[model samples]
Target: MRIAIFTDTFLPQINGVARTIGRLADTLTRNNIPCVVITPETKFQGQRNYELLVSPGLSLPFYPECLLSIPNYTETFQKLNSFKPDLIHVATEFSMGICGLKYASTTGLPIVSSYHTNFPQYLSYYKVEIIAMLAWKYLRWFHNMCLKSYCPSKSTLKLLKQQGIKNLEIWGRGVDTELYNPAKFDFSFRKRFGQNKKLLLYVGRLAPEKDIDILMKSFQMLNKKHRNSHLVIVGDGPLRQKLEQSAPPNVTFTGYLHGDELSRAYASSDIFVFPSTTETYGNVVLEAMSSGLPVVAAFSGGVRENLVNRINGLACSPRNVMDMVTAMERLITDETLRKELSLQARDHAMTKSWDTIFNKLILSYQEIVCLHNKVTA
Candidate 1:
């Protein structure tokens, strides 16, 4: 089936939505299924396998590389009509997604929308708590238009349903075992950070909703206790300066790392600490698990789904600095427990691969098409 994905995030900007859409497009192309990516122009100026329809957009205060596209139904519908896609998959809830929904409604085409970001919970991070109710109302309206809405975790699916979102389903992410393996562990990488120190790593966008300030505070508490430990934060975002200024001397922020460098960073870390509660899936949690690293994440959202609370990794109360520090200290002091969790986490993660997730997505697409055709017939 020919599929068109409309999302605000794409290449030259590293994020989960971008990565997932790119990977799915590659998978579909490899399987002889045509796919098109509808996004704004990126720094890398060139057309990829799927045609890129550039739109008018600009950088925002929160997400820099990400552009907020101006909704142009005329141009979008014109191009989408030519693409002649069997289905349109809206990967984000931004302007591009809204445009796709409008076109699908006009043309009576089936659409599958992915509920990736949790904007309601994210509003508080930007100090816009008063608009929380308004955001939820807008979100409900946007999602209710889709033929089917896909979430990455069951927890998110349940939450969306509770908010009155219809036809919600779970579509989890996968990790590339070959890229994020236990074998990427390099002592040299750790040596560059701090020799003979336990490195606590957090890989994701360093933004407000990520609860980065609390993460820094939790690491500071741990630093006071264990002088031999260090904190390595990967990925960059709008809150980099505030985070860096408030962080302790033990923390090292790597702007961003990809490919082998990202793998090595994950492998060299002794334990992974994630404090964000707004994440829908926490893709880095899976990557950390595949890298054979024991994790300590918040108890809410997808972190609870990814971690088994001491079985695969440690769980701490969300936004609670004390709980996070205690969990970190416990893992640092207990070598046997850490090793056991790491081994189990890796084994569990190795079972879930991109190929498996991609097949499931394809099945969902086929099922949607079959149901639509039956109704039409």
Candidate 2:
């Protein structure tokens, strides 16, 4: 069946949403299912396998990296009408997503949506908590139009349900075990970054919403007692300069790394510490686990959905600096426990495959399309 994905974020952008959509498109194309991705125009000049349609976009004020697409309805309609998709998937609640919703509504196509980000919760970090009520209202209106509103985790599904969004379903994420594996570990990478020191990795955007300050503070506290541990901060964002200026000597910021470099970084690290409580689903957490690195993340949101305390990784109290520091220290000092968790993490990751996840998603799409056809017939 033909599918059309509408999203503000797409490949060439380094966020989780972009990567996930890119992977989904890849899977669809490989399985001989035709799909089209309609997104905002970006500076990227790379080749892609699937059909891509672009709309003029301006950089969002709050998030400069992402664009706010302003599509010409006439042009968009012509392109979508030619593709003739059986289903439309609105991956974001923005202008492009609105275009998808409008097209689906007008053409009587089966439409679905996925809730990826917690924008209302993020308002608190930006000091715009007053608009949170309005944000939720808009989100509810957007998702309520969809036949099925997919959430990345059960926690996220419950959250959307509480926000008055109907037809919520769990659409979990998966990691590529072959790409991010324990076998990718490089001693040279470890030596270059930490030089025999136990490396603690944090891979994601260094933004205020990620609670990076807590990570920095916790790492500082851990470093004071254990001099042999180092914190490697991968990925870059608005807070890079501020974080760099205030960071301790033990912390190393590696801007961003992709492909094998990213895999090596994960596999070589001793522990993965993600302080962010704002994840819809922690993609990096799964990658770290796939690489055999024990995770120490906040026990809230979608993070807690996968991380079991004292199982594959350690779960600490959200936003608690002392609790995070203690967890990091435990992993640092207790070599036996670290090794055991690493094994468990890898074992758990092996069970989650991208092919399996996408196959299930495609099946759901087929079912939705069939039901829509029957009703409209």
Candidate 3:
């Protein structure tokens, strides 16, 4: 099958959405499926079978790293038409994705999309809740072009459905157990921070929407008792400077780590403390579980689907500092419970296969193609 994906984000971007696109393209190419990526220019350099077409872009004001593309429609559409994709997948609701949507709509080609982020939640964080109604109205209209709008989490699917988006489906992410396993843990690396301290890891963007302040405050509260505990923040964002200033002495911020380094950080950590309540799907939570780390995350969104309190992981009430403090203390004090959850977390992660997830997505694409052919014929 020939597939074209138009998205604003692509590797080597640190976000889950960008990583997922790269993974999806690689998987498709390995399986002998023809796929093309239309994304904004990045400092990305990698080997791949699929084609990557970059468009003109400028950085977003609020989101420094995120770029909005300006594609020459005449040139882009000409190339897409010549490539003659069997189906199109619009992964972002930005410029490039809009161009793809326009092309598919005008040419009567089948289009499928995935809802990866909760922009409405993010708007509230940025204090742009005033434009939220207009945003949702626009989102609903944009996604209506999709043959099926796949959401990364069930909670998100229900959310979009309520927001008047039709044909919503679940398309959850899978973790790489081979890469993020306990066996990859490096004791020597842990010694760099503090050999004796229990590592508390947070691996995601440090921004208002991420609720990193809650994490810092919770860690500070936990630090008075657990003096030997360390907080490691392993991702960068616009709020990095502010977060660094607010963070306690025990906290250490590592800008970003990728590939093996990322896996090592996850495996070496004792507990994964995720305070973000705005996540549509917590990819890092799954990665932590794969690394056999007992996780402490907010009890909401996609994280809830994979985490079971005192089972694979523990979840506190979303954005509740006291609840997070209580849940975290349980794991820190009770060594036996911590180890038990670690084992269960790894086992739970094993069930999430990337191949299985991709195969299902491919099936959905084929179905869309079939339906489109019938309609055209």
Candidate 4:
């Protein structure tokens, strides 16, 4: 079936939503499904064959680096409509998504959407407290118009239900087991950071909403007891310089590492600490688990949904440095417990393969398309 996937977030700027969509595009293309990815002109401008539909885009105010694409509705609508996609998927609730919705409305096409971010929760991070309610109102209205909204976890579905969005289904994210495996662990990678120290790793964008300060503080507390443990942070963001300056001596920032380097970083680490409360579903959490490292994440959002709290990994209270430190300490101090959890975590991750998830998503797409076609007939 011909499909068009529209998203505001894409490559050049790295995030879970971008990675997820990119993977889906690749998978769909490989399976002989004609697909087009409609996105903004990215900085890493190399022409690709996937029929990239670029639009005039501008940088966001608070998120200066990330582009907020001003959709060429007339052009995008014409191009996508001509492509004759049996199904359309809007991956973000931005201009591109709105354009996709408008086109779907006009063309009477079957369309689906995915909830990838918690925008309402992000307002307080940007200090836009006054506009948060209005943002929620708009967000709800935007998502409610979709044929069906796909959430990454049941936890997210429940959260959206509380906010009055119906027709939500769980469409979880998956990790590449071959790419992110325990065997990828290089002893030399750990040596480059510091030797004789048990490395505690955290990957993903270093930002306020991530509760990254709590990670640094917790590691500081963890150090007061376990002085030999080192904190290694991967990935960079707006808060990188400030976080680096404020962090304790034991902390090492590796900027941003992707592909093999990122996999090695994950595999090399003894434990993965994710303090982010803002994740709808933490992709790094899955990557860490697939890398065979036990995760210690906040008990908030989708992190709680996957983490079995001591079974797979520890789930501490959100933003609680002491609790996080204590939880990490529990994993660090108990080798047998860590090994058991790591095994369980990897096993769990194996079960949530992209093949399985994508198949289910395709089923949803077919269901929507068939229903829409029948109604029109």
Model 4, which residues run further than 4 Å from truth? 43-49
Report how far residue 337 has shifted in candidate 3, in Å: 0.3
Q: What C-alpha lDDT values do all the predictions have?
A: 0.86, 0.91, 0.89, 0.85
lDDT of 2 by residue, 40-159 (tens): 996556666789999888877667656798898899889889998999999999999999999998998989999999989999999999999999999999999999999999889989
TM-score list, all predictions: 0.95, 0.98, 0.98, 0.96
lDDT of 2 at 31: 89
Tally clashes: model 1: 0
RMSD of 3: 1.0
Candidate 4 Cα RMSD after full superposition onto the native fold (Å): 1.7
**Decoy 2 TM-score against native:** 0.98
Residue-wise lDDT of candidate 3 within 304-358, one digit each (tens)? 8788898988888889898888878888888999999999999999999999999
lDDT of 2: 0.91
Q: Per-residue alpha-carbon lDDT of model 1 for 255-351, expressed as tens digits?
A: 9998899999999899999999998999899999999999999988977667888888989888999999999999999999999999999997988
How well does model 4 score by local distance difference test?
A: 0.85
lDDT at 302, model 4: 84
Total clashing pairs in model 4:
0
Off by over 4 Å in 1: 44-48
In model 3, which residue pairs have backbone atoms overlapping below 3 Å? none
